[model samples]
Target chain A: MWSINYYGNWIMHNIEITDLKRLTQLVKDNHGYDFTNYAMSSFRRRVNRILDLYNFSSVNGLIEKINTRPAFVEEVVNEITVNVTEMFRDPSFWREVRDHIIPNILLNHQSVNVWHAGCSSGEEVFSMAILLREMGIEGKVKLIATDLDNSILDKAKKATIPVKNMELNEKNYIRFQGSETLSKYYKEENGVAVLDPTLIENVSFRKHDLVRGGIFNKFDLVLCRNVMIYFNQNLQNEVLKKLHESLFKYGYLIIGSKESLIWCEIANKFIVVNNEEKIYKKIRD
Target chain B: MKKRSIRRSGIKYCKVVGDLGMSKYKLDNTYRAIVLGGSAGSFQGITKILSSIPDSFELPIIMCLHRLKHVRNGFVEALSIKSTKPVTEPYDKEKLKKGKVYLAPSNYHLCVELGNSFSLSTEEMVNNSRPSIDITLETAAYSYKKRLIGILLSGANKDGALGMKAIKDNGGLTIVQDPNECMIKTMPESALQATTIDHVLKVTEIIEFLIELDKNYK
Candidate 1:
C-alpha cells in the first residue's frame, strides 16, 4: 500500500520487487530466458508498456501468456529490447574507430575479429562493415553481431533502414569524414535504403543475450555501444567481465560516448585509448 | 478540443476524464512527483515556475526541456540558479529525492523507471527531439500512476501532448499552461487539443497551486 515517510506521500506500485522476481522466475522456467540479471528499472518499464500494448488486465495476465503460448515470446522479446541505433551514430566515435582503433587492430593481427554486441537493428554493424571495406580489410574481418531479440536480428540481417533516416545517417557519415558518401554502401528503394549484401557476407547475426549468454569467441575489438546504459552497475560489471575475457591482449573495447567503465569490476583492466570517442584498450590478459 | 480520438489502451493504465481548472482540481499532497515539459521559449517559463516554488515545498520535480541535440547546454546550471530547491542532472540510476529538481541530461531521454529512480536512454529521437516529453511522461506515469502531477508548458512542437494524456489516464493530475500566455503556444495547444486538460493556468497560478498542493503532505 502507499505510505508517507521522510518525503511526502510516496505511491508504491501494486507490483513489487517480489512480483518481478516471480515473473522472472516464470519466464526462466518456461522460456529458459533469464531476466533476473537484466536492469530491473528498464525491465519494469518495458513490462508495463507490454501490458498496455497487449491490453493485459495485469502483470498476472502477461504471466499467463508466458506459461501457455510460447509463440508470444517473440513479441515480448521485440518490445522489451531497446533497439535504438543509427548508421554512424555519434560521428566522432566512428571517426576514432576508423582512424585509431582500426589501425591499432591491424598492427596486431592480419585478420581482425570484431564483435558488435547488442547490435540493435544492425545499424552500427553495417556502419563498421563499411569502415572495414574502406580501410581495405573487409576480406580479413570476421564480424559477429548479436542481440537478445531474434526479431531485431532478422531486421539486422536484412540491413534495410528507413529512407528518411538516411539523411541523418548521411550527415553523420560526412561528419565522421568517410572516404565516400554513405549512399555508396546502400541502395535506396521505395523509401527504404538496403545495404549491399556483400558487406554482410563475413558478418554473422545471432541471438545472444549478454545478461545470460556465455563467451562465444575471442576478439581483437568489441563494440557494445549504447547498450549497457539500459543495465544497472551489477549487470554492467557482469557483462564487462565477459567482454574483458573475450578480448585479446591490448585489444580494443568501444562503448557509447556517454557510457563509462568507471567503478566497474574490470575497469582497471581497460585503459581509455581515446577519451572523447569512448574507446578503451585492454592492457592486460 | 477537436479530435478526442485519444487512445486509451487499458484501465490498468491512466485516462484523463475531463478538462479541469484550479478550483475544480483537488489536492491532498498525494503527489510523489511533479513532471514539467517544455521546448522553445520554455527557459523563461521554467525559471518563473521554479522561482515561485517555496523553500519548504518537498516534491521531487522532473523536467524535460527540449534543446539542441549536440549543444553542451548550461541548462542545469541555469535552472539550478532559478530554483529554490537543489537541481542537478541525475546520474544514471540516481534515486529520485524529495525537494529536488532533476533536469533531463542533454541528448538522453530521461525515463522514471519502476524504482523511485531515473533511467536514461540514448533512444532514437521522438518527434525530432531527444528529451521527448511524451516518452518521459509515459514512463513516469506508468511508474507513479495517480501520484504524479504532469504539467505541459511552453514548447514549439506537440511533444508533451500524449504524455499529458498518459498521466491523466492513470488518474494523475494533468495541467497545461494557457496557450495564450505561452511564448510558443503549439505545445500547450497541442496538449489541449489531444487531451482535455485538468488545470489550464498561467505560470503564476501554477506555482501558487503547486505550493498549496505541497502543504497537503506537510
Candidate 2:
C-alpha cells in the first residue's frame, strides 16, 4: 500500500502521516532541530523529495542514517529549509522600498537598520545592497541577513550564483528600474555569476533560526518574505510575534505577495501599508 | 459542431457511455473537491468546462494551470469572466470554500494540505513548472483520498500523467480529456498511458458528467 508508481519505472513509497510524525520526532531527539511546527503537507513533500534524491525506499532508512551519522543532519536541515529566491523579486515592491519606505526611514534617523530574515542564499540582501548603493546611501544602511542553514549562509557570504539564473535576476532588476544595469554589479566567470564583493560589504550574514533564535536587535524594516508559509498557524503566530518584537515601533514589515498577517496574533498592531504587495507598518509595540 | 447538435445527440451518447463505463463506481455524495490540471493549450477547454457548470455546483474546483511566472495579474480575472463560480488565486493557508474556483498562483507550488487549507511553496520547479500539476494533484489526493475527482486536460508536457496516477492510487476517480480532441494530445495521452483512467471524455461529455454530478449535491 505504501508503494506507488510514477513514470512507469520507479515505485516511490508514500510517506504516511504517522511516518512523518516519527521522522520529525527522530530529528528533534537526535539533532536539536524541531520540524514539528512545519506545515505537514509541504514538509512531507520535501521529505519525499529527499528520499527520491537519495534513493531511499523508506523513512526508516532515513531515520537510521540520522541515528548513525552526526554530520548528515546538516544536509537534512539544508534540504528541509527551501532556499528558492531571486534578486528584486516582485520589482514593484522594491520600487516602493526605494521610493517611499527607505526615504521615509532616513528622514527620522541618521542610519537605518534593516533585517533580511531567512535571507536564503543572499539574493534579497544583494538586491537591497545594490538598491542602497544606487541611492548613494550604502554608507547609511546597516544590513543583517540570517537563515537557519549555515551552508546557504556561506553561499550568501560568497555572493556567487549560477549564470543561468542571472537572466531572470537581470530582468527583475530592469523591472525595478535601477539606475545602472545589473551587469555592473556582477562578473561572469567559469559559467557562474560572481557578484561584486562590495554589494554585500555592509551585509552581515549569520546563521539564525527564525523558530529558535531570539530577537537580537530592532530593525527599521524586516523582510521575512515567503518564510512563514511553511509553518502551521500556531507556529506562524509564534514566529510573527518574534518578528513583531524584532522590529522598532512604526517599522515596516514586508512578506511575500500571497502571505497575510491578518490572521496572526498581532494583526491589530500592524496597519496595511500596501495590501497588494503584502507590506505592513507597525502601529503599536 | 454546433451547441444545438451537441445538446441533442452528444448528451445522450455520453450519458449511455458514462452509465456503462461508470456502472462499477457509485456517486455516493462523498466527493469533497474537483481538481483540474492543465498546461499549454487547456485554457479554452477549461473555460468551457467552467462556464458550462452551474453556480449551484457544490464542490470546490482547484486548478493548477501553468502560467507566466512574473505576470501575476489578469489571469484569474480573465478566467472569472466566463466562469459561473468566482475564480480566484487563493492566498497561502486560505481555506477551501464549497463553491469557488482556486487557481495556483504563478511561480509557486500550490499544495492541498490536510484540514482543508492551501500551502504554497517556492521549491525548485518540477517538470519545469512551479505551479506543478503533479504537486497539486498528489497533495489533493493525500487530503481527499477517495473523495477527490481529478480531471486532466490538454497540455504539451507530461506533468499531469503522474498526478493522474497518484489520484488513481489513492482510490480517487480520474478523467482525462480525449486525446484526439485536445489541441495538444501529449498531456491527456500521457495520463491515459500512466493510469487506468475512469473516463476518456470529450469537452462536452466532461461538462455533462460534471452537471450530472452537481445534481447529486442538490
Q: What is the C-alpha lDDT profile of model 1 across B115-211, one tens digit per residue?
A: 6877788755667778778778978988899999999888888888878887887898888887878889999998888776877777876876787
lDDT string, candidate 1, A17-63, tens digits: 67778887877887867777666656765676577567676778888
Best candidate, DockQ: 2
Candidate 1 accuracy as TM-score: 0.78
lDDT of each: 0.80, 0.88
DockQ of each: 0.18, 0.48
Instruction: Give the Å shift of residue B199 in candidate 2.
Output: 0.6
The per-prediction CA RMSD against the true structure, in angstroms, equals 8.9, 4.0
> Candidate 2: misplaced stretches above 4 Å?
A1-11, B1-26
